[model samples]
Target: MNMSTMNSACPGPFVRRHNPCGHRTGQWAQILATTTAQDQEHFLVIYHDSDTELLPAEAPEQHYEFGPAPAYWTE
Candidate 1:
């Protein structure tokens, strides 16, 4: 996964391959933040351009896996 700095400016849920300094897009999941809730074990996180948007002021870890979903904890 491409490593982008999660900061107030950089924000959460950026395009999987974006430079962060500018608005770019591709066929990728725009990740914002990730939080484990309930007892589910899998890729659980917030995405971009959605209702549950993570504020840019809050830095949060973000990423995405392209291949067939891993065995849950793999992410």
Candidate 2:
């Protein structure tokens, strides 16, 4: 299969390193999916500690902060 098809079929997790409020709490999060609720988009993410949180999709860079995972992260 083509790269695009493969990616679409099994998209990699959207990972970020921070809290919902855009603060670095020494945690890494993986965005699982996006859902709409009450006319707003939200992201379903799970932290490295196995804690799940729903974050606003608007201005994701600010709400669900994004950055490289810490060196300790391992898949």
lDDT against the true structure, per candidate, is: 0.30, 0.52
Expressed as tens digits, the lDDT of each residue in 1-75 for candidate 2 is: 222222311223545534435543445566666666687766677766677776565644443335454565433
Clashing pairs in 2: none
Q: Model 1, residue 49: displacement in angstroms?
A: 5.0
Best by lDDT: 2
Which ten residues in a row are the worst by lDDT in model 2?
A: 2-11
RMSD of each candidate relative to the true structure: 13.6, 7.0
TM-score of 1: 0.23
Cα RMSD for predicted model 1: 13.6
Instruction: In model 2, state the lDDT of residue 36.
Output: 68
lDDT of 1 by residue, 1-75 (tens): 222332322222233322353232222333434433353222223333342322222222343223322333212
Judged by TM-score, which candidate is best? Answer: 2
